[model samples]
Target: MEELFKEYEDKIPAILLEELKSSIDKKTTKTQLKKMLEALYEEYLESMVEPGESVGIISAESIGEPSTQMTLNTFHFAGVAEMNVTMGLPRIIEILDARKNIKTPMMEVYLKEPYNKGKDIRKVAELIKETKMSDIIQEVSINILEATITVKLDRQKMKDLEVRDSSVKRAVEKQLKSGQVKIEGDEVLIKVKSKDDSLNDLYKLKEKMKSIYLKGVKGITQVLPVKRKDEFVIITAGSNLKDTFKLEFVDTERTTSNDIMEVYENLGIEAARAAIINEVYRVIESQGLNVDIRHIMLIADTMTASGSVKGITRYGVVSDKSSVLARASFETPIKHLINASLVGETDPLNSVIENVMLNQPIPVGTGLPGLITKVKK
Candidate 1:
């Protein structure tokens, strides 16, 4: 391997020198010429793959003294056909190094280009074979286990406690009557019963019990509750906000816009958005769909901008013309309107552009778009 590498390395510099001479226009100063050639060579070197520190491959041993040589005669057309000249080992080394990085290790390289173009691919394969590196690289897949806990109280305890105290029993009965407790097999499932599902109480409970329960399970990764019509969701084990959102639903008639905003206010906008995005990405990825996280970032930003939890395709906060896309496309109506009103036409577009470029939305509507549109004559 060292001998092979050395052969290629020796051939690279001469190729580079020749290519540089032919490519540059009328450069007479030796110092200037050498500098330019050196820079190009350095660039070519930099483009080669750097073995990651964790890869455990000693660089000095792997990249032995390069020695390789090849000559080519080609024609160039700049008006009339002219003699095209080329030369050196350095350029070849550069190409070989680049090809090594470009080709997936231990994989057959299939090249598609003009004229016997698969030559590079074949060359890369030959290099891999010659270097005896076919078995050195391995592919790894990682699996992460994310677990959450859902707590269920003993129904007997709940009922007994209610029966023991008349006033507390009355309150508990009221909650049960209101469908707060779902009884399943002697277990009292206690979920949040308020329209405003604030997790402060749950947080308090978790804080109080966390140390005691820490030994039983892993620390609470995320605390999320499900929300239902006119009822708050129970905070269970998972921290996935998006899943929590799906578990939460509001009856359009029973829940008011104020109620939704209040819920968002209780959970910080960033946290809420992160949860929603995590859930969205989870669903998307599970289906073997590929989407950049930045798209989710945009969705999160839009959701948080209005302080209302809405889906990506929803036409409320995200669909507004004064949001991120509008600013990016130079069509922010709200900013333009504000600037036009305050600074008039004399204001520079640059200033308005700069001002609206901040990743925030201008307040309009309920911040949350209404589902039902009211018609007017």
Candidate 2:
């Protein structure tokens, strides 16, 4: 039994090391790494693998965190001046495992010295807030207007412009009684009840004034236009519109160049951009396509960088160096075998035998096959 355990332990590390190497070569994003690990864990369970059978074999949850915080300190180690890392989720796991301090799947680690505490957490929170806000504003429109006041009319509270002989109250009453002015809410409206040709001229002037104000507002809201081969493209310039594009699905069909331009005219450039990105993301998600959040993030970044939305790629935000073989190797029963070998002090071959005796999961691409041994006389 001891010899068998030793054999299993030796093989466990070898398998795990190979998996780590593959992960590095592929430059797998953090999300991909997590998915690969989860698939392997499922295989381990089916094979009924046990702990202490492998080296460097950890639970799936050990390396999985929805968010990660890293803290670094600049210092000199061995005459090398550089940044020394003190705290991070990954580092914490490594330290705890090295010391065999915990066996739980999820845990947290805190640092004491050489670390600027709470800084990274604050930064991450701020960034998330900014991202969420940008996402929300991507669909809205902004407009600014300036207008000139015309036909000003005023009635004095005093009955006489010469106030030497009149009381203020009496003068105010006289103004209200007269048809010289009208008050609507806080505004004073002067009635221009005249059929003179000059009144028509005044009306025309008011219309012109309003038109000019609208044009000025439109100019401020104008955004950079995209040059398409056969059509003109336009997008808003605002973080909110960019973020709205992050949604899984919203509305894409209505997000054409003309529609975007219309938004620019009605809402302004910032609101138009937000609307377009939101619509684009909505369309992509509605098609049942699987895309990483990082891909969307990259698109937003590219749009901002070039001041136009175009040229997004899979490899832009995330890599595609996936390996089926490497993924399968990590899923094997090798970890359990290695742990058992190390604990029982045996060899790889013996470890396999003992694992089989325990009816534990064995390493296979999808799952370990059931085997039957026959005795001959």
**For model 1, how does the per-residue alpha-carbon lDDT over 1-377 read when each residue is reduced to its tens digit?**
22332444553566765565576665456566656655666787886545333111232222222221122222233643122221233322222222212111111111222212332332222221211111111221111121111233333543422222233324334533432433344223334445343445544433332222101112212222223443332222212222222212212222211122223544556655665455445534543445556555555565567655553332444244433324334444575556556754443332223334554332332322326877997
Q: Among all windows of ten consecutive residues in candidate 1, which has the lowest summed lDDT?
A: 102-111
Cα lDDT of model 2 by residue, 1-377, tens digit: 22332433443445753564455544556566555555555665566645443322222222222212222222234533222232233333322222222111110111222221333433222221211111111122111121112222223311112221122223322432322333333233333334342544544433432222111111112232333343332333222333323322313223332233344444554654564455344433443443444443433444334343222232221111132222223334465446445677333422333345557654432334456889898
Candidate 1 residues lying further than 4 Å off, grouped into runs, are 1-163, 168-263, 307-315, 322-377
Each model's Cα RMSD: 29.3, 26.1
Specify the highest-lDDT model's number: 1
Q: Which stretches of candidate 2 lie over 4 Å from their true place?
A: 1-181, 184-199, 205-279, 287-295, 306-377
